[model samples]
Target: MTEAAGKSYDGLPGAFRFAFSRSNSWLFKLYVAVALVLAGLVTIIFVFALIVLIADTVDASDGSISLLRSFFVLVGLLVVLPILAPVLFVARRHRREIGDDTGYDRRLASTGFLFIFAVYLGLVVSTPPEQQTSVDGALGPVLEVLYGLPSIVGLVPPVVAVLVIYGTHRLSR
Candidate 1:
């Protein structure tokens, strides 16, 4: 019985690893594509926010920055540096894969991007707007803009991602 079962299993295909799967379903591709783009955007946003925070603190400092300000900057830098590693790794891998002759996995790229975006979004949404606005001077204005032009701001990422993906696909061909 065991021998027969093993033979039957061997004849079947391998298990589906979520990130590594090569299935060409449109829904899966869409999900992944959105995810990849989101990840990149989130990372960029995070780095930008950190820079803005540090800059604001420095500007406000009159040659006597508070210990709290210094500590916050130090902590933000430490956090941002580590977060950058995965983003850089994914980017480098994507570049190499695209340049290679063996064709790259769009799905995998999408999955990675989506994962990063989800994490970033989760963190942002979890934080109260009041706290975020207090920490970053730009947040208040940015939020106002987003609120004022919800339709435009909401569509930007998806539209840009589609154009980028389409351009890359065209170039690769």
Candidate 2:
């Protein structure tokens, strides 16, 4: 039998060739690589924040605030994990779809990944804790719960979620 040839889209139209070529365009690869790296970094940061929050709880001056802060940190991780895990899957699979002739939702998924990350960034670390509710250096009753990262990280998920929903819908259609 004749040797099986590699994918040959030499005669295909330019756009089709680009889409189904046996490799990713530099743009797609770079986008995915950057996004994945960011996600990993963010995950590590979240874990570290979690550990700090937990360790701080043992001898916290005010147990309520410590407990609340710890609770929010844990909640934030739960939210982040779902979004981050899917990104890793889509990014790896996009290699074939962009390079070796495959079909899948790449742009939409990548956008979702970045969107969630940006949101988490805002929610978890939106403001400096020292400045959140420290007016004239007189701590307020709301000081503890008010300065947490989760409250701010909360902003990212909804926007990312909306984008993801739209992207998925477009992909489906």
TM-scores of the candidates in the order shown: 0.29, 0.45
Best by lDDT: 2
Best by TM-score: 2
TM-score of 2: 0.45
What are the root-mean-square deviations of the candidates from the true structure over C-alphas?
15.4, 11.0
How big is the RMSD of model 2?
11.0
Question: Candidate 2 residues 62-107, lDDT tens each?
Answer: 8697678767777666555545443333333333343332233345
Give the whole-model CA lDDT for all candidates, comma-separated: 0.43, 0.50
Give candidate 2's whole-model lDDT: 0.50
Question: Candidate 1's residue-wise lDDT over 128-151, tens digit each?
Answer: 445554335867765555444434
